[model samples]
Every structure is written in structure tokens, then in C-alpha cells.
Target chain A: MTGVATLIRQPWLWAWVGALVVWLATAVFTGGKGSGEVLSAAMTFGAFFVIVALGQMFVITLGPGNVDLSIPACMTLAGTVAMKSMDGASAMIPVGLLLALVIGAGVGTLNYSLIRLLRIPPIIATLSSSFIFQSAAIWWNRGLRVKPPEALADFTTAKIAGVPVIALFVVVLAILGHVLLTRTIYGRGVVAIGQNMRAAHLAGVKVERIRAATYIMCATLAGLCGYLLAAFSGGAALNMGEEYLLSSIAVVVIGGTSVAGGFANVPGLWGASLFLFLLVTMLNTFGAGAGVRLVLTGLIIIGVIVAASGGKART
Target chain B: MSGRLSPRLLRSLLPPLSLAALLIAIFWLQPRTMSYFGLNLLLNLAIPIALATIAQMFILCVNELDLSIGGFVSLVACITATWLHDTPLLGIAALAGLIAAYAALGALIHLRNLPSIVVTLGMSFVWLGLAVLVLPTPGGNAPEYIRTLMTLKPAYIPFPIIASVVIALVVHVGLMRSAHGTVLRGAGGNPRSLECAGWSLLKIKMGMFALAGFFGVLSGMALVGLTTSADANIALRYTLLSIAGVILGGGEFVGGRVSPIGAVIGAITLALAGSFLSFLRLNPDWQIGAQGAILIIVLALRVLIGRAEARK
Candidate 1:
């Protein structure tokens, strides 16, 4: 009983509760019809969100004022470049994937240089860089949508035992992410820097190197997500990554990660991602208009953030 | 001490210097822009941008960012073009309500210690939703009075210049010179001190948010007046533009340091950057990239100057 009580108090538990509650709400609303379908759909889409949010979580965990506003543009550029490189050729998939990762690394390097060398704030640096990336995407393909290769698309959309393959892959990835956050020196360094940069540096945490690695890791994951998302959706559009910007941040905050930095919640990422998808799915199922749906999303997000952050008192 | 003061002075001078340089380059490239008519053509759209920058500056002074400013401006524009044009009283009430809502949001954020970015991100959705609900298709008439006011040509100078000058002076006087403004800014610079000094942080935050809302309304109304119409997504870009404008004008993200006059100038400089690109005949596809490059170059210049300062 005590163990269960402690589990209930964990910050990550609320997101799971919220996800389950919304899922049940949707199930109840439809008289249990299509509930399985809704859950499957949530799993499929939620995987993409979890991928990006994972990167974002690491970035946010580094400290306040540290966020990657360029995720959307990076995704667009990567997806566009990768799709164009593959060009419906299964044989060129590895080359395209490598190219996407390279683009992500380059973007991350530029973003970090702007922050470190130019001494610009991270928010402004990433935001400005996004414009360049977005324009690059536009200039490269002129906003054209290119279809993914046959085998890649099939693998992305394929399911095993009613579970999406991508979702399963991401679940294993999340387990690895959990181990990386809690059981690694670099992870501890990130948390240390977030808690107190000066102390972290004094303790020989290699603050700059750790920060650099975290950012590069984040962008690399964003790259992989873009590649898979393009494949899953059958094509890559210019505006494909636009909605992920908000959703990525929303998932992090809603998952009960401390916005102030120094803390992380890996399990909560999955729950929050599913909850967000289901919330939208619930609204859509009820035949709510766009305006109403958006308003409710805003209000509900506010509610969740409030509830999640309620326990901790900050001066 | 004198050497340190020189660097501070130099930092203060960068915004105006850059604006002048850009202006001179544009005039030299397109000599016709030197005339009053050409100047109006170049700067007419800058009025709303300057207002939005000022709104952003107000929030920056309180050490908060308003990601919803773009959406808020879009909603205001929709209301101005639709209700304000057709039903004047109803429009006034709606605008007032929006400003009140902004103040309420500030109180909620301050009391709960919620991250402003998340709250405002959510509010951005709400504002966009409301704007879409109000103007589904983006066709509305600007109020007759607003249209006339926007287009009024004064003697000896263009209206945009006059309006921008008045705006800068008014905000400068209100926020930079007034005693109350100091207290408001102090809330951001050192809230604990202000709390110890027995000032209500909540009221200060509310005032700042309300001021931001007021300027956002002006930006939206001015934009609609100039364009003679409104759309749900009309000012979606203003959020970023305003932040860039504030930074260009030497506003720091966390500090309470901000310059109203410089912010307006920075806004004009950015607006002129678009014109400069067109004059240069840059490819339309690369214009956005060029804008980003310009932002990076300017900030890089700031860093170079700082390095010099540090060496000294």
C-alpha cells in the first residue's frame, strides 16, 4: 500500500492517469465502438510526437531559457531532403537516412555556435536559424511533396499484433532513453548543469561539452523522427512539421517534467503524447468545430500544467 | 570606470547606427526613396510593426514573453474589421474585454508561478480559434474612420513618420521617465527587492500585461487600417518580428533593459530590410533566408563589439 501510495505521488503518474481517463472518455462517448481503432491510431501518431518530445525533454532538462524552437524547421528540411534523396528508391534509403542525420548535426552545430560564439540567447538563435532552414527547404524543392520509397513506407505503417511497428520501436527507444537519463554520466552532467551551472563546472562535469552533446543528440533525434514521419505519412510536405513545435513542448510540460530544469521524466513522455492525441481524437469524435477544439485544447493544457506543477512550490 | 562607460555608450549607439546605415544604403540604391512620397511608400507598413515591437518591449520589461501577441493581434484585427466596423460599441467592448483577459492571465501566471511560454502558447491557440470563428474567410472592411486616419497626409511630412515619432515619444515618456514605470520595471529586474519594498508584484505584472494588450490592439487596428481588411492569420508573424525587433533594439531577454524609441527604430529597420531586398532584386525564394542571415549578422556584430569592450 505504501509503495502504491508512493507511485501515485510520482510526477509521471498523472500523465498516465490523464491519458487513461481521456481514452476511457472517448471509449464511453462512442459506446465502446472503435475504441480499439482510436487506441491504435493514438499509438501510431503518438510515436512521432514522443520522438520529438524526447529530444525536447533533454534540451529542457538542461536548464531554463534552453529550448529548441527550430524543431519544426529541422524536421521539414530533413524530411524534404531525405525524401528527395530517396526519391522512391528503396536502394538509396540508407544514403537518405545518413543525409538527414548530417543535416540535423549541421543545424545543431550552427545553433550552438550562434549561442556560444555570438552569445545570442538560445530562443532567438534557434528561432532565427529556423527561418534559414525553412527557406532552405523551400528553395531546395519549391514546396513540393515527395513520396517515400515503397519498402520504407511499408515498414513505417506496418503493425504487429495490433501495435504499430514504429510505436514498438519507440517503446524500446524510450527504455534506452530512460537508461540514458538516469544511469549515465552525461545525463547526470546535464542535470547538474541545470541545477547549477557553476557548481557543475566546479565539479568537473565538462559543462560545455555536455551541453553540446545534448543539443546534438536532440537534433539527431529530430532528424530520425523527420525521416520516419515522412515515410509513415507517405510523403513529406513543407508544413509537415509545423504542429509538432507546440506538441513537442506541450508533451514535455504536460508529462510533469520540471519546467525549471534539473529534472526529467521519461515514462511521462509516452503518457503525455498519448493523452494529447486522444484529447484531440475525443474532440474530433464529438464533432467539435476547429474553434471549439482549439479553445478546449488551450484550456485543458492550462489545466494540466497547473495540476502537474501544483505540488512543487517555487520562490 | 570611463572605459567601461564608453562600452555601455557604444552598445546604446548600435541600434541607431545600424538603422542609419540601412537607411543610407537603401536611399543610395534607390535614390527616389529620398523624397517624401517614396519615404511614405517605404515606411507605411512599418507603423503596425513598430506598435507590435513596442508591445513586445512592454512584456520584455516585465521579463515575460508573449508568444500569443501575434494571435492576439490577429484576433484584434478580426474584431476591428468586423465588429468594430459594423457595430462600433460592440467592438470597443470586445477589445476592452481582451485587454482585461490579458491582465487576468498575468495574475494567474504570477500567482501560480506558471511558465508564461506554455500558458501563452495555449492562449495563442485560443486567440487563433476565436479569430477564425470571427472571420472564417478573411474578408472584412476596415472602419471608415480608421481608414481615413491611416491615410491622412499631413503637410511637409508623411503620416507614418509622424505617427512613429509620436508613438516613440509617448512610450518613452510613459515608461522611461515616469516614476511608476521604474517600479514596474523593478519587478522584473529584482522582484524580491520589490516585494520587500512592499509593492504588489501582481499589480505590476498585470499593468505590464495590460499595456502589452493595449499596444497589441493598436498594432492590429493599424494593420487593418493600412491594408483595409483583416484575416484570421493576418499577423501570425508578428510574434517573431516583435521579439526580433526588441532584441535588435538592445533589449535583453531576462533583464528589464529595454528602449521604446530604439524598438520602434529597429522595427522600421526590419521593415525596410524587405524593401532593400526587393530593390536589390534578390530572388523571392531566398528573401526569407536573407532575413535570417541579416539577424545573425547583426547579433554577430554585437558580439564583436562586446569582445572589443572586454579586451579594453
Candidate 2:
């Protein structure tokens, strides 16, 4: 019972409770689909958010005001690369994934240089890279709608033991992220640096190298999200990745992570992703237009950030 | 020899020098852009951008950012197209209300100790929603007076060039040259001292945000005036453009350092770059990448200069 209460007290617990309330509200209002079915459907999309938010959480946990603004562009570019490289060949899946990772690494390296070497602000550096990445995606696609590989699509769409394969895959990834954030030296180093950069540096932490690793990890995960979402969406499009940029940050904040950095809630991130996925889907079902839904999203982001940033500042 | 030239002088000279170099390149490659008409045509977009950049510079001077500037401008455009044309009094009242709301937002932000970016981002959605409510679609005409004002072309020089010069001078004089401007900047650079000096930081920030709103309205109105029509999404790109302009203009994120003249130069150079790309027949898709490259180069140069100063 104490364990249960403690779990409820966790920062991410509200997101889960809120998600459930929204799910119930949707079921009550729509009266069209069963709650279980809608939930599972929501999870299918939530998987993508989970993947992206995991990456965002790592970046956000890197410290105060450290944000990865290039997630959307990276996701879109990764999807484009995967779609272009695969060209409907299941045999080329590995190659496409490799290409996406390589490109993500290059972007990460550039971000590192811009922030560390050139001393450009993090927000500006990443935002500028977003423009560059989107341009690359546009040039690659050139308004062409290439079909995703048949075999990859089939695999992403498949079910396993009455559950979505994508959901299950994302769960595995979440577990991996949890382990990485808690049970590794790299993770500890990241947290220490975020908590107090000067202190960490004085204590012999490789602050620069760790910061570089955090960015690389973020871009690589975003790349992975792009490739996977491509398989789910049938094909990659130009604006597909746009939603993930802010939404990913929203998800991280909702997950109970301190906005000032040094801590992250891996499970909470997954929960928040699920919450946002369900919220948007439910809103769509109610025939609330895009503007209304966007307004609500903005409000939620403000509310969550205000709530987090208000109390989470380290003394 | 280097001691003869001050660091501040070099800093101020660099942006305009770069702009001159770019202009010379454009003149060499596409001589057609040198004429009054050609230059006016190419720089037609610079005025609104300069206004928006100045608005952003105001916020940056306080170590805050207003991500909603684009949305606020869009809302103003929608109003200018429909309400401003139909009922001028109501339109002016609405714009005034927006400025007051911006001041209130600043107070709320300061009171709550919240990050300005998220606050403004959320408000942006609210602005876009209101814009959609007002103008549901893309088609609305600006008032005749606005169109005429935007189209004023002198025979000797381009209207945009003259407009930009006036704007830079007016803003520079108001902020940098005025007494109250120091108090506003000091609110960012040294808040405790300013407070000790008996100024209300709240009032100063509110004034700053209100000024941002006022300029945002001008930018939106300028945009509609130039295009003669308005849409909610029309000026959304100005958000990023304005930020880039501020950065290119020799402003840092932390120090409350800014130059109105540099921002105008940055906006003009960016507009020219866009035109130059089109003139070169490069892929339209390449423009974003090229813009990013330019931003990176300029920022990288700034970094190099800082390092050189440190060495000196």
C-alpha cells in the first residue's frame, strides 16, 4: 500500500490520471468506440511520441535551458532518408537505418561545434540547424511521395499477443532508456553536469564530452523515431515531423522532469507521451477543429511548464 | 595600428560592411538589381521584417523573447484587413487592447517568474485562434490609406531604403539615446541596481512588452499594406526571421546588448539574400539552408571576434 501511494506521488502520476480522465471523457462524449479500442489505437500513435520524448528527456536533462530544437527536422529528415534509401526494399532496411544514424551524427556534431566552439546560444544553434535539416529533407523529397517499404510497413503494423508491435517496441526502448538514465556512469555524469556545471567540472567530469554525447544521443533517437514513424505512416512527408518539435518538449515537461535539468523520469515521459497522444486523438474525435486543439495544447504546455519551473529550481 | 580603431567601432562597422559587400556582389552578378525600381522590388519585404526585428530586439534587451510576435502580427493583419477597413475606430481600439494585454502578460510573466518563451508560445496560439476567428480565410483587403502609404516611391531612391533608414534612426534614438531606455536595459543587465535606484522593474518590463506589441502591430500592418491582403499564416515566418535578424545585428542573448541600426542592416541583407537566391535560379528549397548557413557564418564570426578581443 505504501509502495502504491509512493508511486502515486511520483511527478508523472498526474499525467496518467489526467490521461485516464480524458479517456473516460472521450468515451462518454463520443459514445462510438469502446474505451479499450480507443486506448489501444491511441497507444499506436503514442509509441511515436514515446520514442521522440525519450530523446527529448535526455536532452532536457542535460541542464538548464538546454533544448534540442531540431528534433522535428531530424525526424523528418530521417524519415526521408529511410524512405529514399529503402525504395520499397525490405532488404535495404538496415542500410536506410544506418544512413539515418550517420546523418543524425553529422547534425549532432554540428550542434556540438556551434554551441561549444562557436559559442552560439543553444536555442539559436538548434533552431538554425532545424532550418538546414528541413531544407535537406525538402531537397531530397522534392514533393515526391515515395512509398514506404512493404515489409517494414507490415512489421510496424503487425500485432503481438493482442498488443501493437510498435507499442511493445517502444516499451522495450523505454526500459532501455530507464536503464541508461539510472544505471550508467554516462547518465550520472550528465545529471551531475546539469546540476552544477562548475561543480561537476571541478570534480573532474568531462563536461564537454558528456554534453556532446547527450546531444548525439538525442539526435540518434530522433533519427530512430523518424525511421519508425515512416514505417507507420505509409510514407514520409515534409510537415510530418513539425508536430514533434514542441510536442516532444511538452511530453518531457509533463513527465515530471525538472525543467532546470539534472533529473529525468523515463517512465513519466512514456506516460506523458501517452497522455498527449490520447488527448489529441480524443479532441479530434470530438470534432474540435485544429485551432481549438492547438490552443488547448498551448495552454497545457504553459500550465505544465509553469507548474514545473515554479518549484523545481535547485537551491 | 589596431589600437587606433576601437572595438566598438569595429563591431558597429562589421555588419554594414558585410551588407555593402553582399550588395556589391549582387550588383556585379545581377546588375538589374541596382536600379531604383529593381532595388525597391527586391527589398520590398525588408520594412516589415525590420519592424519585427526591432520588436524582438526590445524583448531581447530585457533578456526575454516573445515567440508570439508572429502570431500577434498575424492577428493585427487580420484586423487591419477586415475591421480596420470596415470600422477604423474599433480596429484602433482592438490594437490598443492588444498592447495593453502585452503589458499585462509581461507583468504576469515577471510576477510568476515564468519563462517568457513558453508564455509567449502559448499566447501565440491564442492569437492565431483570434486571427482565425476574425478572418476565417485568406482574403481581406487593407485600407486604401495603408496601401498608399506603403507604395510611396521616390524617384531618386527606393521607398524601402528610405523607410528603413527612418525606422532605424527613430528606434535608435528612442531606445539608445533616450534616458528611460537605460532604465529598461538596466532592468535586464542589473535588476537589483535599477531597483535600488527606485525604478519599478515591473513597470519597466511592462512598458517594454507594450512597446513590443505596438511594433508587432506595425509589422503586421506593414505586411498587409504591402501585400494588400491578409491571412493568419501570412506573417508566421516573421517569427524566425525577426530572431535571425536580431542575432545577425550583433545582439547577445544574455547581455542586453543590441543595435537598432545593425538589426535593420541584418533584415535588409536577409531580404537581399532571398532575392539573390531567386535571381541565381537556385531551388526554392535551398533558401532555408542558405539562410541557416548565413546565420551560422555571422554568429561564427561574432564568436571569432570575441575570442580575438579576449586575446587582446
- Best candidate per DockQ, number? 1
In model 1, where do residues sit more than 4 Å from their true spots?
A311-313, B1-5
**For each candidate, what TM-score against the reference?**
0.97, 0.95
Q: List runs of model 2 lying over 4 Å from the truth.
A: A1-9, A307-315
Candidate 1 chain B: worst-modelled 10 consecutive residues by lDDT: B283-292
DockQ of each: 0.67, 0.51
Candidate 1 residue lDDT tens string, B108-142: 88888898889888898899889988898878999
Worst 10 residues of 1 chain A by lDDT: A306-315
Q: In model 2 chain A, which range of ten residues has the least summed lDDT? A: A306-315
The CA-based lDDT of model 2 is what?
0.83
Pairs with steric clashes in candidate 2 = none
Consecutive 10-residue window with the lowest summed lDDT within model 2 chain B = B4-13
Which candidate number has the best lDDT?
1
- Give the per-residue Cα lDDT of candidate 1 at A246: 85
Predicted candidate 2 versus true structure: per-residue lDDT over A1-315, tens digit per residue: 999999867888877877887888898887856777788877888888888888778878887668888888998898898898899888998898898888777777888788998788877898888889999999999877778888889878888765789899999999999898889988888889879989999998999998898888888888888888887888888888877876787788778876568978888887788788788777888887767776776676677667655533212
Clashes of 2: 0
